[model samples]
Target: MALIAFRRRSPLPPAEAWRRVTDWPRHSAHVPLTRLSTEPPGPTRTGTVVLARTGRGRLGFDDPMEVVRWEPPGPDGTGRCRLVKRGGVVVGWAEIEVRPDGAGSVVSWREEARVRLLPRLFDPPTAWAGRRIFGRVVDTLLAAPPRSAGGPGRPDGPGRGARRRGT
Candidate 1:
């Protein structure tokens, strides 16, 4: 399996940073030829299955991951989540952690993944690709504006329903 790990710092608060990183669908925006969806279609929690389909029509693979652990940032401003890949073509695990930083936050992503039928000799290139791809995912997520809680048509503007400090 290829081991991938990296960290990024964001000016957003820990909660906001956590929200951005954990929003499953947003991931596909940065990964080429990929689209993400979640099982049960609600707030993410333990057991939520994230399905990522990559490739062009008929020539693709599904990467399904089950959330084994879910802990959103609380008053202390720290959170962690773990997902286990349960796909025929991809297998491994990924973990994400977010913590408070000085007036901001830091998020870390770690994964041990391997494509089915791939040889161990390819681990280096796999790790390199994973790092580059996921690194861009994280950076773009943090840089984007936070999404609105109620979405379009809501009386309030975007992100209005999002939890605020002391709320």
Candidate 2:
């Protein structure tokens, strides 16, 4: 099993940061070759099922997860969420916490995972990769969109897209 923890500070408010981080669909845009689908679709609360499908058709696997705990930010500006991985290929749990800081917010993610058929020797690499991937996801989710239409890049934010040379 591999245990991973990542933490980052965002300039956005706690509520805003929580919303962005918990927006499951937005995760697919940040992660490569993966798609997230939520069942009992709607507000995410306890018991919501999230399935993350990775890789291409026939070559992919599903990481089924269920929201075991869901607590959105309140007046005090602190929130927490926990998901339990229930898939055959992956089994573990992940927790996300958002806390308000001075003029911003801090987000923390912790995950413990065990991959079936994988030797313990691979755990370190797994943890490293998990941190790398999840770190990018956090950065992407926290990045502020262009302030105006004239700002560089897409309104959705900077990413791979058409470039008009010599404009």
Candidate 3:
């Protein structure tokens, strides 16, 4: 079981941040590779799981996820969100929280995903990419949530991603 955690600071409040996360599918445009399905979904909360695809054609690894748990921070200011795998054995989890610091919010992400027996093929690169991806995600979120639309926002599209080390 490999583990990687990323913590980011957001200019948005806990409530607003929570709203956006729980509403991932609608905001799928902001993420790198994700596809929303037409099937009816459930409310956004602890134990509520949502189904979605990934990569170019996600239909191949058809699996849904369970939200598991959700904790809202107090007025002093700090909230947390946790999620776990649902049906399939390919377990993947992501946790993001916000702590109000002065004016801006401190966002944190902790994720540990397992691809079962396919470890040999998707380990190193996955770890390497996770770190960079998290940073890019943070940068994108810092830019005032594009008001014209509602969804996750990225610095740029696929072709214009942050220049990698060697590139």
Model 3 clashing-pair count: 2
lDDT of each: 0.83, 0.82, 0.57
Per-candidate clashes, comma-separated: 1, 0, 2
Model 1 lDDT tens row, 52-126: 999999999999999999999988999999999999989999999999989998888899999977889999899
Worst 10 residues of 3 by lDDT: 158-167
Rank candidates, lDDT, best first.
1, 2, 3
Off by over 4 Å in 3: 36-42, 55-59, 87-89, 149-167
Question: Candidate 3 on 10-60: residue-level lDDT in tens?
Answer: 556666655544455543555467654423354566766666566675335
Clashing pairs in 1: 148-159
In the range 102-125, model 2's lDDT, one tens digit per residue, is: 888888899999888799899999
TM-score of each: 0.87, 0.87, 0.71
* Cα-based lDDT at residue 157, candidate 2: 52
User: How much is the lDDT of residue 54 in candidate 1?
Assistant: 96
